[model samples]
Target: MTSTHSRARRAGFAAFVGTTIEWYDFYVYATAAALVFGPLFFPSDDPLAETAAAFATFAVAFLVRPLGGIVFGHIGDKLGRRVSLVITLLLMGVATVLVGCLPTYADIGIAAPILLIALRALQGLAVGGEWGGAVLMSVEHAPEKSKTFYGGFTQLGNPAGALLASGVFAIMSRGGETFIIDGGWRIPFIASIVLIGVGLWVRYRVEESPVFASKVEGRKQSMPLAFALRANWLPILLGIGLLPISTGGYYLATTFATAYATGETVALSEQLILDAMTVASFVEFLVTLPIAWLGDRWGRKNIMYIGLVTSVLTFAPFLLVMPGRIEPAVFLLASLVRVAMSATYAPIAAILAQMFRPQARYTSIALAYGVGAAVWAGFSPWFATQLIAWTGSVWSVIAMFTGMAVLAGICTRLAPQHSDEAPVTASFTPRTDTRTNRLP
Candidate 1:
């Protein structure tokens, strides 16, 4: 086998497993927020208010994500993607494990929730860097003809992590009411200890991106964040717009949907919701690769358009079924929504990397995705509940989802697509004079 192909394989595998671990840590918090965080940490007179407060803590991480992006983006751009990624993985793992060990409101009063939020903030910082670097590692190392397919490896983390989180929680939930409330949820959070070792081992094995290594010499920006904003602000804005359905909307389906179903709004069983989500997550894991493969043939934007239209149409139905008392069909809808979501999620790795010139690609992609996630995914559940509290109708939340979908579709149509230019490729040579040298 050729050296390039072998390196790409290692990079792709590292990206896949590393992101799975990072996202697994992230998803555990989301699931806990929706299910048990209120009683364990927030503890309020009004259940709805308690749920809202729990979500508020969940949103805290989003607030910190943009800052994390800038700090690590600079590191990735100036130092290397692999260096930035390893630090992120370690940081996230430590924070998540700490969260599993945190005391509840009953144990330490306000300090309990305070510590929880602090740890979550640290997680936000780690993830903000992890994603942009992971995607770049996979996409940049890929052969041009199969870039989308390889990019899908990084995207694979979302569903795989979600699957692991949901599945683990499903098992924990089986311990019954006494077990779940007592401390069952903590098990999933703590179990992540094992994953960290695996993530660290695999991430360290991967080589640096060939593209970044070749182009990284004198091309780095002194202020990559500032330069990215000045030069490629339009694509960055469009990139943020393009992400609502994939990031925030998916959270809506998983986080908010689970919360709403179990709460007084729909009053569905928690076990049922967790079970359905497990099935849906498994289905999503299965489908992401196929959809990404299709992106290679039909164009990433076109596949995203397909995902947008389907997700928009399904929003109301997906919500409608929540209150309708459907059985396994709820899982079916969840899987279908995720299938549509995969169209957007899987292809976006290649899309975002291609959108930016390699000059400040790390910073540009990180900043754009961080902001987009903060705006969209961060507040989706909180806002959905607020809308319900104000209007006394779930339709308001559905309307918001539809609105974001419409905006993303328009951005997908308006945004520019990237192409590989052979003329530019042969002219540039890899910088190898100093293997350990970095930009000043």
Candidate 2:
């Protein structure tokens, strides 16, 4: 390959790897909250309330994500994607390591949970910034010929991160509950420091987004959120409305599956849940890359329509089959549920990022997409688990998933096609960058 091609490819891969590490730090906490934190951190006599509290803490992180997205989104739009990328990785890595070192309720009374909340909030903030920065790094640097494919490549980090987190937790859990509760959990959280160093090194070598660089040169407004809101409220709102189904399905397959299988009287083995997650992550990553390629050719909305329809038809049956079973058949079914999620996820970054001008692209996409995705995806596992417990039927969760699919489908139908959307591609011009104020 030519030197230029090689450099871009390496840059894209580096961005992808950084995304994997950032997500690994994020998902490990979610996994622990699902299985172990209720017992270890909360230490309550009432099992139900304890589980609820744990999920509440898990959900609290997402509540902070919108703010994170707005904050980092402004920095990215003004300072450049590279700067935002470095800040987010360091923030996530430090928070994760701190979580590893936190004391449990048994050791510090109520202070333990309070400290845990603070750390998790930091994590939420870091992740809020991470997605927008990573997506922009890959897609902005990507060539015009393969925009969707390269964009999806960055998103592939989500599954890779999930695989690492699940694989590590699985290996650690084998040492038995006592081992996991006592110290095994710390191993995964502690691993983030090395990952962060590697991510920082990779990100530092990449140049600023071509789009942002040019926007600066053209005397564009520095305040991206204001520019986005004033110019593109319709698409922003639509993007927000469209994300619940994609994220809701993700939580159902990963977080809720573990809880429903383990938290109930008929709890399945932790090993089984981890194995299923590993396989699902593998399949989703493999499938997402190719589907994103198709999205570039066939149109993102068209592919999304197919996915949403499939989800609407399959949601009820999938959830119905998930509980009271733990075999190869159920495993295959679970993996397919994840595949459906991957279909929507693969093209979403590019599609959403396409909605605004280059100057405001970062903030518009991050706040609208990031905030919506976190609220829908982050809280989903907890919501599904609670719904299952309250209704005593997996069908209720399935119904919820199906409803979200329909909602996303409607929004997808309304979205402007890529050719119709304004361009966000980077330019060669140079100018001063402006930092925007944070969104409310």
Candidate 3:
């Protein structure tokens, strides 16, 4: 028992650290896209067109995520989770550093945005593979009763990264928009190299997942992706359906909101939005573990339902109040919405992991999350921008947000749970018998 607890702690910490760095690298690009990428990379006469183009470059990463999942997921299912994760960290770090070094449109014209897209694509690929392995490393190592709690550690990386990214930008924006637009953004990207070194060292210190070693080490799947598609398609689809809030909704609240708040519609300062996001991220980070513990006690799906419902309710007010430029209201609403989001996001790692058997869990989860991100997260900001551009109202965005939350809630209720460990009472029960290892 002592040894198991110790191992779980080590794995959870390593997963948290690795994912935090990956997310930090990813969110920095998101921050830049909302703030500086338009003028710097994709220069345009119309501000809206420039913003749309910048978001398009941001979306490029999501396009390649499925491929990254396939490539690295295969490596994870066959070689080991630890091996794949280390490679992803290195890939993400190198790409981020290169982004910091790239010349802007003023310097290189079309080649500049083209190179930016390429680097962002690389980032998408790395993060595409990064999430599943990190979640599995923590959850698979945890004792059965504590799996959700440990899995929450993996989820922690999201807000922690967001907090770090937003906080860094908030500090830098103190130098003013002139400073940020000129060169302040590059510091975060270049500094990712140091984080990559730290992540590599921490990830190396953790052992391979005992689940993989015991069940899969000797007999590797020849084609994990094909196997996942054939046997795990239902769960994969359900997983995708269940992630609208965690994926698209999150970007809507942070990335799109930042741009909208700072754009002509709201005309708030960039620093204000960044500061609000930083506060929200910090609040979400603080509450994530407690919410995950609640999921363990009350039920994973129950907690998710609560989050989904509240997100819709809170989001409407946030949209309405944001346009008013009320500083205190903006700060309060941002944090409140993030707390609601954390309830939805924190328990999902374990829920998704348990939805598939060990044979191709890495590929299954990665593909589900990657494709979902591509459709929901990758395109959401751009879509919301276009919707506002066309309809001339933020309420269109509110309608879209509500629809996503509803979809995710339905999927969460229906998704099957399959695990090698003891069954979680609150999670969805599989209709098919566990003894036969078959899905309904």
Each model's lDDT comes to: 0.85, 0.75, 0.90
Model 2 / residue 210 / CA error / Å: 1.1
Q: Which ten residues in a row have the lowest lDDT in candidate 2?
A: 431-440
Assess every candidate by TM-score: 0.94, 0.91, 0.96
> Could you give candidate 3's per-residue lDDT for residues 321-401 as a string of tens digits?
987889999999999999999988998998898888888889999999999899899999999999999999999999999
Q: Clash pairs of candidate 2?
A: 210-426, 210-427, 211-426
Residue pairs with clashing backbones, model 1: none
Task: Provide the lDDT at 83 for model 3.
Answer: 99
Per-residue lDDT of model 1, residues 1-440, tens digit only: 37766777788889999999999999999999988899889998889988899998999888888888899999999999999999999999999999999999999999999999999999999998899999999988887766777889999999999999999888888888767778888887888989999999998888888767777556667888888898889999998998889889999988998998998868988889899999999998999989988877777777888988898777678888988879877888888888888888988888888777777789989988899999999999999989999999888999899899999888777665454332334333223212111111
Runs with alpha carbons beyond 4 Å of true place in candidate 2? 1-8, 312-315, 417-440
**Order of quality (lDDT):** 3, 1, 2
Q: Which RMSD values do the candidates have, in order?
A: 5.4, 5.4, 3.6
> Which residue runs of candidate 1 sit more than 4 Å off their true CA positions?
1-3, 420-440
lDDT of 2 at 126: 82
